[model samples]
Target: MKLLPLARQAEVTNGWLRERLRAVLPEVMRRARVDLWLVVAREYNEDPVLPSLLPAPMMGARRRTMLVFHAPEGGAFEALAIANAGVGLDGFYTPMWDKTMLAEAAEDQWACLRRVVAERNPKRIGVNVSAEIAFADGLSKSEHDALMAALGPELAARCVSAEEVVVGWLSRRLEGEIEAADGINALAHGLIAEAFSPRVVHPGVTTAVEVAWWLRERARSLGLGCWFQPSVSIQRRGEHLGDLGSSPDAVIRRGDLLHCDFGLHYLGLATDTQQNAYVRRLGESGPPAGMVAALAKAKWQQELLAAEMVIGRSGNEVLRAARAAMARAGLEGRIYTHPIGYHGHGAGPMIGRYDNQEGLPGAGELRLQDATLFSFEMFVEHALPEWDGQRIKLATEQCVAFRGGEVHFLGGRQTAWHLI
Candidate 1:
């Protein structure tokens, strides 16, 4: 597949930004009971939502850039960028402060912000502050102090945390974004397939670290970026490398069961996938029956988890339902699925965690929404009769989206092992 040119990618991203600003922002603000949302950030420390809102190629927030979004009772909300007029944001935002205005004002950006607030007189002012979601907690100490001082006690009294607004905006995936994500995910899957093949991995000569670096280089060659370092691990007959035991220096060997945790970032969207492969020894035609059966159990677990992704249901609720279904099927496994989009572990509901499978408190309570994507990550533990009754864990993570009242894999899930 051909990668989008840098210029083309920027055009597509800016188009999506326009759609998001016009359609998504107002609804999200209203849902969170926010009349006015204030997002303030400095040069290097930008609010997570700010980057998503800005036009592409504008690397970071420039010199105390402040974005104020005011949603009225109806109609399009006001989008004002409290920065220089030459920043090329005229198409999307009205520049509230020019260089001349800043030079004449006592407290430039703050004064502009205050004037806007006074003019609008919004009932509820939402600022980025939260203990629940890190993506929503973008307000820095100095920025918060500046905002409070500018608004004074009376106006500050109306201030509320914009956690819901932030999550809602970040979690909701547009149709165009979902289409672009599908292409990016297909590229990622192909890269992983190539990395796990004999062209890159030689049983005794290549180490896990070598393969990992190859994957990284492959991404760079295709003008793509990885959200996390690619990990390669082997689980042999007697050696159980546990979850964290996949060392970079471990040498690949014949008859080893290989696993990889990989992700790719492209066009501002992210993809997370975990897949397994088996190396064929001298005369072996295929994997043993026990190994094949273990993978089938993992596939069944994937189906069970996907079935519980009901729209409007909380992640915790989905987790409960999935666990009960798995129990009914007599399957032993753990589910740790999370939203994947803007960030690899993007905004929205978190179904479960590896260590904390019971439920996540604040994040897990978030309800699922249509048009959002998730990383269906989980593992199944079963005893393999072919390996002298040794128990092994078959783990899988694939990108899937909830749309039209059903869950669909971006690219189909890995059913067969990637044979090496």
Candidate 2:
């Protein structure tokens, strides 16, 4: 599927974003304990926070642009870079680039960065580099080696981790970005509902693979992207994550359960949703007695998982709470949720993986930030004694945001599945 368009590039005014940056910059500096932040990258290499740092007009990274931000003990921050425009840092930065000097100084990126560091003169320097988060691994290995050699041992020793600052910025959602994300999520429901209709899925005709490709093609037709590969499966009687039977070789039969785990990407935002559908027979009124009960119990488990989202709490806290709630309710389920944003699987506050829920160092350590977006992802399986006697697994995903100390669903949660 094709990726959806980015938001229209608009004029940034002296508004909340500017004010928030002013407040956040100093706070980040103090927390990170770094007087200066030197973001060094050649063309095509950018800081994980580069999009947030740059002004609207610059699309791709410019050559040898080193953004420098410093907060002195007595005054406002000093914002400048090796370019004419200072990444909206003009309020606190002094432009230090001259066309004549850059043309004659050297063709080397490392040499230029060293000169700027010597001129700026700050105690501590912070660069984005981390072992846990791939987003922070923007610095190329060769570039890192060159930087250390050119800056000398003393200056190189000043580098510190920018993980906390990166997490704080990425997890904290902006107003415009939230609105766009919400709209994109709502569009996902429409795409799936239409794809599951009889027009695309004819009983005894279309295979699961055919229906899956149709979903991807339909999304491409609507000018959007899929977060991962779209998956479609039919759970007849007995199915498991390990084995879902002989891969839908048989035709779609009456009273069969059609389950799908899919989502679409719109406006640069990715969504994850899973849903179930039942095929009606010649005189059957609705889904079989057993499948409905199993789905109901699964839905109950969904509620238990969603109710635990809290603000200012670590991923580990919410995760433990969800498990406790699940045990109290006597539901068998698994939770594997992650942060979703500008990049899919974005970059903060990971709840728990299906396999590893005991806790992770950097992953589970991040606390929930208000206004942050997350995909409420998990699964529930229940056994039915009423029908032919089998277990059915139900999974659904919806976008939820932590705002004002509470979690609110973006559009709405699916209570019942759409019948095919």
Candidate 3:
């Protein structure tokens, strides 16, 4: 039931990924009300929707997986791909749609695609073309040119953006995908634990830079992929510091507050986690009182943030509600949660980002739905009356879902600092 890595054939059930994607594609086609659905791609080049529609670790169209769905929905969804790599979409998909053999249009794959379109003659064709959310921008320039040449005079006018349906399909989760996403999201938290423990630090000597590297190496060796580099920092007594873009080299002195923000991508899902750590003052069995309360406040903020999860609320609505709830609790913080599914930060409803609280006009305006995964990236910045006059900072992140109108964490959040 878990969505395992594509290469691990035995670990995953076959056709599961495709089944989920196909089940939703129609909704996309239906919503757009387009006459024909055309997806174009080649080996190395794939349409924005390719991975979801593909047969995993998709090498490319040995037989491509291009597909077209004519309006009126019946019969199998038409598809095309390279010959024999076993796209296995036979009936559902056909081999190359060649109007001319290798002799004509030798350098392009679009020649064959035109044949599929010419036959269907869709009035408003949906292409992966888009103005935002770059993943949906899958078509290549050369392929665009060839498609234009083959379609002739009016083809340009026929195309329109598939952004809405594409975002809905890609960002929205199926029942089965949640099972896979939850199973692997644990890896992200595990990486955080390892980086913060005594095993990776020497207190007075080890620096955040060392822990960051450990995260990268650990993820690589374990076969867990990272969307971006991991970040580790010693919040050693600070007040106002912005996004710590890189791992700081400051020595990890005893009594310093340290933490890491990291995650790994595996199978077809991703996990995001951020945890705080305390470089124990020698012989002090626990974190300083201020640090303990700060971590506690961060956890509470997450709890309050989760309270906003309700079906049918748009990303902006949920975000506004979560922030208000935090403020009501007398908590000081920020939330930058994003939909996490097929991609690291998949295309569902975004809870919040750093600067864009009002939200982008499109994706951010999308509504929240159950059975979808999200990175509950929020923070608590309060004056820890217990720390030195310099003050301190605390932040923690965990993955969760708004399942059936309630928000639940994948594994759980770090309520206390990693004791090293």
Candidate 4:
């Protein structure tokens, strides 16, 4: 899994950003009924959505950078960048505060923003302020007040929360991006396979913590970033099934079931995967029949969830439908799936929370749109006859993309355990 050099990575990201702005912005604005959208961020305190909008090389916002998107219904779309100096965004955004165009250096950036809005006179002015999604609520209190003062009363009256456009723009994935995610997910899967093998884990010698750190170090060795710490847990024969597996220091042993929750960040996309491994005891060919059956049930739960991920269905609606199906199958499970991309728990509809299986509140109410990526994360419990009918939770997670009204697993899912 070779990564592109920093310069090449920047080129690829900038290209993707350009395509997104040109192809997705206008339609998203129209769908949200927003004629104008403003994204404001300062140098250190930048908006969550700002990095996604920025070029790859530009790590953070310059001194008080503001992005303006003017996309009216049945009209031309304009992307404007208001900053004190050039931020290498010439082709992507039309510069609003270019030094050459200025009559004097004393002009304020906010004043330029006011002038731009006055000329456009858009009916609906969308701002990055929301009570629901944090990704859409990027505008700071001071910035909001200053914007209101700059726009004055009448223009400020048209201000509205840009949740719809923000979510739509952030969640939507292009064909190129989806393709990249497929490869990124494969890299993560490969790393997990290597870590679960005898080369890294030795029965009775390697502790769960050792394997977890190995995963983290392996990712860094491959030049990959991890959004969260890698976790490894053990489920031995006499342990409680629902105890979230054994502690981090639990040692690997023959006939023990191993589980890991790992994620890697690469190419501006994140891949989250939870997989299971079984240590083969002497003279045993594979896992016990009961353990195998439990794994099968876990796969079935994944299918049930996938079946309900229909286009335009709200996250809560999907969760309800999937749970009903699971109940009909008589399987006990919990699902806490989420959209994944730039951020690990990326911006989009949140299906269910582990603690609250019924549904989430604000994010769950959002509908699942096409061209989005999600992590199929969940667990199912089943009794193992080999362990005297002790119930064990078999958790599995894999990256998937929903496009063209269909669900495509980024890399093929784990149907069988990685035997160590």
lDDT of 1: 0.87
Tens-digit lDDT track of model 3 for 1-420: 233454575235345655654676666567667656566677667675666665544444543445665554554554455333244444445556332333434334555566667766767877777766676678778776766677776766788776666776776677676776666666577667777787888877887788888889988877667888888876655533334545877677877777677877666667877788777776899976777778788888888878878788888888888888887888877788888776777887788887776565666777775667888887777675546555555677788876888887787567667888
* Alpha-carbon deviation at 12 in model 1, angstroms: 0.6
lDDT of 1 at 338: 95
**Runs with alpha carbons beyond 4 Å of true place in candidate 1:** 100-107, 242-245
Q: What ranges in model 2 sit over 4 Å off?
A: 1-30, 42-59, 62-65, 71-74, 77-79, 83-96, 99-108, 118-120, 238-251
Residue-pair clashes per candidate, as listed? 0, 2, 10, 0
Residue-by-residue lDDT tens digits, candidate 4, 1-106: 7889888988888889999999998899999999999999988998998989888678888878889999987789999988755566677898887554345455
TM-score of predicted model 2?
0.84
TM-score of every model versus the real structure: 0.97, 0.84, 0.86, 0.96
Q: Tens-digit lDDT track for model 2 on 301-338?
A: 66676677777678888889988888888888777788
Candidate 3 Cα deviation (angstroms), residue 352: 2.4
**Global CA lDDT of candidate 4, please?**
0.89
lDDT of 1 by residue, 1-420 (tens): 588899999999999999999888899899888999999999888888788888987877877788999997875699988886666677889878766423554457788889889889889999999999999999999899999999888889999999999999998989989888887888889998998899998999998878888988999998989988888877888986555425458788988888888899999999998898888888988888888999999999999998888989999999999999999999998999999988999999999999887888999999998889999999999897877888777888999878987988887668788888
Clashing pairs for predicted structure model 2, backbone only? 79-92, 79-93
Model 1 earns a TM-score of 0.97
lDDT of 3 at 83: 38
